[model samples]
Target chain A: MRRLCVHTITTKPLSLEECLVEFPKRGVSGITIWRQALEGRDLGAVARQTREAGLDVVSLCRGGFFPAATATGRQAAIDDNLKAIEQAHAIGAPLIVLVCGAVPGQPLVESRKQITDGIAAVLPAAEKAGVKLAIEPLHPMYADDRSAVNTMRQAHEICDALGSPKSVGIAVDVYHVWWDPELKEQIDHAGKTGRLHAFHICDWRTPTIDLLNDRGLMGEGCINIREISDWVDATGFTGHREVEIFSNRLWSGDQREFLEKIAASYAQLYA
Target chain B: MRRLCVHTITTKPLSLEECLVEFPKRGVSGITIWRQALEGRDLGAVARQTREAGLDVVSLCRGGFFPAATATGRQAAIDDNLKAIEQAHAIGAPLIVLVCGAVPGQPLVESRKQITDGIAAVLPAAEKAGVKLAIEPLHPMYADDRSAVNTMRQAHEICDALGSPKSVGIAVDVYHVWWDPELKEQIDHAGKTGRLHAFHICDWRTPTIDLLNDRGLMGEGCINIREISDWVDATGFTGHREVEIFSNRLWSGDQREFLEKIAASYAQLYA
Candidate 1:
């Protein structure tokens, strides 16, 4: 079955409660809530409402951004990630998505080492809390200031070094990895290794305005989402296809209308 | 010894003859002329003036855009590349930079294969004309409408398969490959293989507005231009770091002022 997951970023203007209500109303199978939306709200109440509404918590928004200029900053990030793990566990979320951080005032090699160390520091806490950590490899464009883990091969190598298939895996986001020449091969490798943890869907707009926002809706851009989804499905992982678009245009639209468009887009491709 | 090369796109508003005259006045060591500027100009006169002005024609930009839906379109592209090779030879340029085409009407995979095949088809003419075909792997943002060849590894693989080290190589643009995870490794590989042909320099703005025209001037954006140039230099591949920014802001400025800015920017970084 093609399970649909609503990433809260698609309807970021709405509150977590509003997003939760909107998801079920739009016929989404699950919801992936961002940590930002959970801010200033009762965590237990939001979690309870999600459960009461019978919405499947696919995965938590994120918990990685590890690279930091100072030791204090690094430690603070780790502490924050620990809290994120606890939040995921509280909400009955299966995985805590990690956007492994990038070059901090040091060379890339040193930054990569720090990323690994940061992940290792949080592994034990996440393990104890029964939360799977999904390391999301962002597009290489974000390697400088965003995430250093920019390739599946690199992420898999990190997982291998850690020596725990259950503790660490990867989230395959098409927006980030669609342009990779080795994407298909890496996806196959991830599938064979059972390291494919989450699936993300979005498009690369032709005239991308902003590096952070300006992401296209699934079918609006050139990425063949259906082909990539088929590859993910071939991995024998039937997880939800989370619509994780960070588009300013979409965000400004009516929340209900946006949800309806997402459903329509998903149906056009996956259904 | 460091050399100076003016990318014609810098003076895109000027006529080709006017552009040629500007290079000598600016005290530039060489010029990299684009095909668009050469479209209706007299090739013989342009070539003659290039020599008369004592300008070393470093490279010709460009001749690839190979992905097309029809066989006739592909053939037309091949013929056009042949003409470009002739033009490069006439102008005394050592390299004809090939922006290997993108997906015609299909997904990236199919487009990538066409790009490789297109290059393979054109290599003989390039070799015959004594013109080295430098495959400029554009940023992945261009993988859809511009160039499917989006990585150094992919470009190197095509060069390797073609089996003529002198006939095919790559033009490393900082704006394109600055974000690559395996950039250093690929640069080293290109160096070892004698495939580092031409080096183009530009910066990627954080909030890139237009996919094509929003490139930042060096030192303005997040790209570590010095580090990337150091890698290129380490390869023992002695080539001019050609300034190739496509900026609306710069283009709209006074032509002489724009030239002065580029010269100053180059001096700060390279001199």
Candidate 2:
């Protein structure tokens, strides 16, 4: 129960303060905050409020969109990532999940090179801030525009290319990697190399309506979340199992009910 | 132009007879007939009509849904595949493209095994009919309900598991596999093994609206179609560059104009 974390975006309708109030009541002990939830708020006060509510600030929701067509754009992305590091530090988040970016018409290999360079550019700031960057390898469906890093192997390659810095690791999100045949092996490799930093839980619905926001609740879809969670646990990953769902169907409903459902599902999953 | 092939479902509004007429007029020299198009049609007559219209019957659109929870369901899939082989033979099609199925909540490995066994079960019939089975590894997004076989590597593994039969090869659909990092290497391996049976061409739209029917025509989206086609060609795969778009947006339009746009896009892609 202590390990159960919910991303702020999971309950998008709720304010950060409301989440602080509601989540702990629902037995959610940890939280991964989306950047959106931090808008117009004092980071220090938000951090204090979250701690006062007895919630661990697990990680910042995202910090990467590193690929861009222009040199200026790439540099801007790097600057933004550095800002994210500052934000993570201010909010007392120990980690930041990166959704490495891709350009639509650009070659993926090129985008990947840019991603590596971008990460390298920002690694110093992240390290100085005492924040770790967990590269969340996005689903291949997002390879066109959302991310160039779409596999655990690719994420590992970026880490290797960046000289295997201890500050950089991977966030294993089941929504992105469950379909991968090499998932178990990759999880093992990430563990062996001490790069397994975070674990995310979500289900993939059949007849997925929207490419971006149609994720199902834990028991509502076909993903073997428990098996994947076991594999993550087998890696000695004592990290928060972050519930990060982006579902229009779920978001449009009662957020309190959604939180209750998430808690129930999490209980059944671990039980 | 000689190598341009269109799938019947790409122009869903048209009948088999209408496709035989319209496709040739649009300079589409080859046609991959979907099973739906063959419904209620005389196979011999359809074959004759296709040939008489000067359109080559390149292959059958699809014939695999092997994974089932029950043995009866699995046997039914095998039986349907056998029927597809018969249909392919009757229509003078030399190959059949397989969208290998997946069962939701079933272990992918188990589904893959069923897919292998299903292919093996129907292989002798396919061979007897001189019809090659092209295992089209669907995109990972389809890994839940569409296919457990979600990469060229998995497709190759299945082919290898089946003793690397010449009758069982692979269908390289750009829409399904363009995101794979090992795509080039896998295609080369398939070529070296004489398992490069088919080359499917379609673009992947950035905001792909529907999981099943939102495929873009060549040059309309982000896929590196020409580059992937070059990879296929490098493998000595001088097979038809089959156009297999499944777009609700396209289907609802005036199909004649859509065919013209496809022709234009194909010309630009090759030119």
Candidate 3:
């Protein structure tokens, strides 16, 4: 419970203000803020209020979509990522998760090259702002149009390509990576290289209806969450086991119930 | 087009009889028979009819669900697979493709071990029947409940574990292995090892709506089918370039039209 964090997008129905008020009440120790939830809000005040409620700002939800069809499109992504870095600084989030982008028809190797370049371009901004960037390797299902970095090895390679910059690392998300046979080895490598920056939890539903938003709660699906968490913890990672689910089913429900369910899942799987 | 083959399920609405008559007419030189398409038919007669229609029997569509929670279930799978070997022999399909199974909640490692054992058990019958078993590595999206074998490397490992038998090899499906970063290297290894039994081609739709049935025709989606086919060709694989798709949208339309589209796509891409 002490290591539990909940991403604001997990309960998409809840506002950041609502989360700042309710997350602490539910014994959630940390909150990772998605940019959308900061819509028309004072970033500094949200940070201050979250802190006042005794919640640590876990990380900013996302800040990468670096691969694009054109140089202009790629530049635009870099500009947006720069803005995200500034936002993360204002919100007192020490890290930003990256869903490194891919173009639909582009070769993944090229997309990956672009992703490495994009991260390098944004690294200076992140370093200057003291906001670490975590590349979240998405499932290969998203390898077409989402992140080209669909494995921890690919993310690690990108970080390695960028010269193992202290500001860049990998985010291990179980929903995306639990199916990987190389998961434990890669997780071990990430930890050994000090590149395992974050751990996100959710389950891969057996009949995952939607590719993007059908993530199941911890116990609802078959992911070996406890084992993966143990691996993360074995690395001496005392960071938040962030609950970062994107589920239309759970989001449509009462967010209090969902948050409580997340807490219960965290307690069962981690505590 | 001379090297072109199509799986029966690629046009799910078509009966085996319809495909037998239609595929050769469309200049698809071969037909891969799905077990479901053979219901209530005389296997020998179908084989004769397929040959009489000037179509070579490429392979049997599938014969594996090799992992189960219960020993009884696992035995049942092996038994059914043995029957599939007999059927493939009876149908003159010299090969049987295996979509190795996974139990949802079972640890994948355990499931993989069971998969290896199950294949070993079925190997004797396959050898006796003179029907080769091609281990088809399903996409990782299916790794939860559909297949524990989700990469060529895993399939190769299983083959190696079984002492690299001549009776067992790999079925490379582009739709399944396209996103794999190790695809080209693994394919090269498979070819050099003489384990490349079959090559399957299908387009992966951008917003792949359904995990099971939302495959696209060649030009309809993002997969580099020609490039993958070229890699297979580079290995001197003169065997059929099999078009295997499962599209509900295409199935709901006129199947003849769909078949024509497949033909056009093949000619445009491969010819």
Candidate 4:
């Protein structure tokens, strides 16, 4: 019943060893590993260490950036994603969250087409590995370079384009989608289609200083986290309310204390 | 054949007199007046001065912040908007742009309801003064404190909720809406309903330095302005393609040079 998951990047200051030791001790039931956190480490051993501590490996932090100007660049991205699928398999993560990319100055429609193609290219590998690929729709501010898919509707369209394969789904992030007018309907639709593979939570600061690194902790900013949770929950998504925060401010602090605060905030929001 | 208008705030360094003189010399044929540009000057005299410069008064800069925590706060916003209507009337401006506000922690649904009520409360004055109210949906970045209307569809929905009054219309700004997947449909719908009252342009720069003031100049960033403009024109729109950029970088330079650059950019994109 304890379903709180924290992204490894949320505590960037902590080493993988630190996370393995600290996360389970905090009563946190799950961990999503960022690829950077495993650099030069033995992933199979890392998987054993993580599960040995009674923490579920919820997902790999990311595996996308599919839009590129050159065919070679795009193919490289697909290769990287295939490698991510292999890593996810090794680490025993059942899912890979994708920040499907956008190229600056490239047409989003073309980038979208490329994204659809990229995902399709990797679908067979994902299915072979039994790894679900969750397309994370980033905030629109990131439309210039981070993603072309900036809404759940577009994500659904991409899924439909890919034939709604069981291995392909969506990752709902509150920081990216809280302002959407069509959120309730989109969530219900994602649920009805049984493609809501992941859920992420964070708050939007009033004067978000940096688009990439200025996320607010829950209850510290303007998002109605509880209401959004209720909407996601209404769709029968009884999975990890995964905490995926990227904050320069939060990262510089005592990461253990910061994560304790995470537990506190998640508990208070869901209380 | 000149179809370019410039927002006064785009040249923040310039006085109203400077805009009246310089905008036309650069082949910019229209201007949208921000309330701050008027200061304590006589509105009627300012209107006469603008006309004397052979410039069309496109619209009053803004008048909407409907959502507040209290009934008293909402009433105060309405009172301010009514004053804006009077100013628009006195200045001979035919339209008043509405930013239709949001509260930091308030549910957007409640803010939307308040915005609808607030607009209805002002419809009679707007109708009497013959000033159309153009709902300019702010970008999702501003949804925390600027406006709950973040999409053209939402703007159209508000117009519909208000019974599609002749005085209520939507302003399409490419900066806020270029990322929308439903953009073409929304534009076509607004046109079909005869609610597309205004069109504005700018671009989205990669590595956008600041949220509030780092807007890209025309053709300086990634928006397919010509494509979007074609969409607007296809809907039988013949109004000025207003340049409403908010760039601290551009404003800090010589404003005259900036205006010329804007003219050049417009010519390149639209010619």
Query: Candidate 1 - CAPRI tier?
Result: acceptable
Q: What DockQ does every candidate get?
A: 0.42, 0.85, 0.80, 0.74
> How does model 2 fare in lDDT?
0.94
Residue B259, candidate 4: C-alpha displacement in angstroms = 1.0
Q: lDDT tens digits, residues B155-206, model 2?
A: 9999999999999999999998999999999999999999999999989887
For each candidate, the alpha-carbon lDDT, in order, equals 0.83, 0.94, 0.91, 0.92
Query: Which candidate tops lDDT?
Result: 2
Residue A222's lDDT within candidate 2 is: 94
- Residue-wise C-alpha lDDT for candidate 3, range A29-92, written one tens digit per residue: 9999999998899988888898899999989979899999999999999999999999999999
How well does chain A score by TM in each candidate? 0.96, 0.99, 0.98, 0.99
What is the RMSD, in Å, between candidate 2 and the native fold over all Cα?
Answer: 0.7
lDDT of 2 by residue, A1-271 (tens): 9899999999999999999999999999999999999999999999999999999999997889999999999999999999999999999999999999999989999999999999999999999999999999999999999999999999999999999999999999999999999999999999999999999999999889999999999998999999999999998999899999999999999999999999999999999
Q: First chain of model 1: TM-score?
A: 0.96
Candidate 4 has which clashing residue pairs, if any?
none
DockQ value for model 4: 0.74
What residue runs in model 4 are displaced by over 4 Å at the alpha carbon?
Answer: none
Q: Candidate 1, clashing residue pairs?
A: none
How should the candidates be ordered by DockQ, best one leading? 2, 3, 4, 1
